[model samples]
Target: MPVTDITTDPQSLTMTLTAEFPAPVERVWKAFTDPSQLERFWGPPGWPATFGDIDLTVGARVQYRMTSPRGERSSGSWEFLSIDEPRSFEVIDSFVTDDGEPLDGFPAMRMTFEFHETPEGARLVNTTYFDNADALEQVVAMGAIEGSRMAMAQLDAVLQDLREYAEGKGTRVELLDDTHVRITRLVNGPRELVWRAHHEPDLIRQWMLGPDGWEMTECVATTTVGESYRNSWAPVGDAEGEPFGFEGEVLLVDAPRRAVTTERMQGMPTETLNDLNLYEEDGATLVTVLIEYPDKETRDMILATGMADGMESSFQRLEREVLTAARP
Candidate 1:
């Protein structure tokens, strides 16, 4: 697929995605279980993922190395948390730094993979748990969005392969003014599901994030027009963490794949984000999120905060998930 080279501030963050697959439960399950099959699709794409010694049992240890185009090797290990043959599994995924030192940052990602049978094929659901908001924020700030979008772009990148796929459409930052920055993306799910993704408390826990150790204490959004709601997002170990993010509000909710605006009480200003989900030629639905910030500060803040790179990266990640979930 055509890759999107996402660049970011490495501090402010972006990228959040979710997808559904049309393939069977058993097939999708194997893609995760069998190292060989998983390796075929995993990694940064166009890059190499060398699956070394892999042991799939629970509490088992495995070492895998991924080499970038520059031939730099990054190694990570996986510890199985829970596993059900051809069903579901969970694991704590982390990277091992050179000199054998354990790096305690971004690589410390946890994931829960699930496979469910459907009339046509199977449903694959991957819920990635964060170590804390800091890592989540860092990755978001770094290149999560661009990375995922690049991965998802692979779908159109390759046409002959019959495999899984996912995507989180590009965001629209309608330069609202000199003080605000508008941002939005299209999600490939029903309006209810998409709405729930942003509004539901339990669902928000899985996708929203903050600084490495920070966790969202609460996200209460009122899905109504003119009825405002507040969301409390902060560092885990320290609720009142630095760069306090005690903010967030919903201005309008256009049910079934559409939201009008958003506001950050103290951190950032307000924006009108129009999120839309539509269909493509091949029967796949495409999502489009359009946002308009209130003024120049927000716009400048977003740009200065590495908005372009971060948004691009988030798009890439969403692309990856979309391709994976869209596969039949």
Candidate 2:
């Protein structure tokens, strides 16, 4: 219902959709940038979406899939071209195979989303440029226009309740698939500080501790793409639990924004890929960690160990001890 106009211009080889929302541009922008909120309305009615490997930075690629009521699935991807926080972003959108490659015979399109404040609230102008008139006609014939309308129609509810969706939610976890899990927490700190706390050994020792009475005995942190890092912790002063540690090699690094690593318990042969992403809005940073397990059994075993609860403790400590003290 938020959609006010939908137009296709053959001469321009483009399709555009305009919609208005009763929310500020910042809130509207978050709904699109945050994978959690984006997934809620990105898919049409019965077809819900699940996003994976989402990094909103320019040059990053995001993969997602929409599942139909009858269990049919369609995969897609976005290659980010540009981003101007809270205002606009552009991406190359394409229908992709399960492996994330563009499907044969399906042409990719350039899509730009612009957000502007209006007297009523905010307005979004989304335009998609096809390679040719034939491409535009092809998409329209395949229900692109109708699908977009239905998708945008669901945005109103998302915008209306975004606060309830994000605020005060401590460390939260979502089982993305049989082998993937996403954990998110909104830390009361800026992205730069959060990123530093993650990479700086001294700062990390202060808050990365899960519970009281545990101390990080070893903190060998690294940011180099090919470098390996290790962390070890031991309980102190009658505290229970054995000393344990994790080791991993950095796979990707985008300073203050995103990082990916292969992590595993020390001496364990199995490893999981961890993708960490940070996004800041209005001073508070949203930390999202996507973990890919080797299999469903490993995924279940890890979750059963109350991993999210321990992470919640660490996040709380991070804000209470490190972030608050660092702020002016």
Candidate 3:
């Protein structure tokens, strides 16, 4: 299951649930906001919720109804208190009648949802706060914990489907030779813009960051045929550890067209050869990367380290921060 932890704080009358999903933050936010998508996984097993009157803005009210196998029905309403897009939201949840009237003496809780980015994908932390211990216990007695687990499991399935659908229409990575792996993507900007972003130190620093909290400490870009370049990065908050960095020698340069270099990281034992080719297609750029390792075993070992995911994330950052600005 994707849910990693669930805890109830009796003193605070709150329940906290943490779950991780192998999907981008934006997609997870969509699943929460889109009513059709929510209906797919919004209830426990054997009972599907039908959502209606969904208004996601602050102060808006949303309604949903769930039916049991024995023809029993339960309805609920949510009054959105705060909304922070693609990140977090707060809402007041309460039981309601079929006609949308509140149920007297029933349990009501304040729910908060927080979405954070992780290396693998995203993590969602949900907390429900009750007015008192009695209110919290009342919801637990109604099978809230088990129902939530089942609903989150259904969300995992939905995320898997989204991933499969994306894989069918995304960038292509392929093996070209015993020593070479080729990655190809159709970038949004023109060839010149893409080339500049790769060859300019200022541009590289903007998009070549490591994860969210790390920034490039130094960037030296030398794009000549025989010159060299070096780059280093460190975590933003702390400067105690040795910085991670890479240095490379340019072997071939064909301005805005193709470049080949030999690169070696500070800690990696094997030096690799990288060839970047940019082509202009329909006013956009098609970027192709060919990385040559020492041997097939060395290439497999590097691939096994899950380097592709980091590379993919860097590419996305480049598109979002550099290419978007370069777009004409």
For TM-score, the strongest prediction is 2
lDDT of 2 by residue, 1-328 (tens): 7999999998888899999998899999998988877876798654567788578799999999876533467999999999999999999999999999889998899999999999989999999999998889889998888888878976764676433546698888877568878787888888999999999998999888887889999999998988999999999999999999999899877688767888999998989988787767667887878788989999999889878987888999999989999978
TM-score of 1: 0.41
Q: Between 1 and 2, whose lDDT is larger? A: 2
C-alpha root-mean-square deviation, each candidate: 20.8, 10.0, 19.8
182-265, model 3: which lDDT tens digit per residue?
A: 676666677898999899988998887746667898899987767888889887775344568888888867687667788888
Runs with alpha carbons beyond 4 Å of true place in candidate 1: 1-17, 98-101, 104-107, 149-328
Better of 2 and 3 by lDDT: 2
- lDDT for position 64 in model 2: 93
Runs with alpha carbons beyond 4 Å of true place in candidate 3: 162-328
Q: RMSD of model 3, in Å?
A: 19.8
Candidate 2 ranges beyond 4 A from true positions? 1-164
lDDT of 1 by residue, 134-235 (tens): 777766765556555544433231221221233433544544234433354544444444455556666655555532455566666656665665556565
lDDT, ranked from best to worst: 2, 3, 1
Clashing pairs in 3: none
Cα-based lDDT at residue 286, candidate 3 = 59
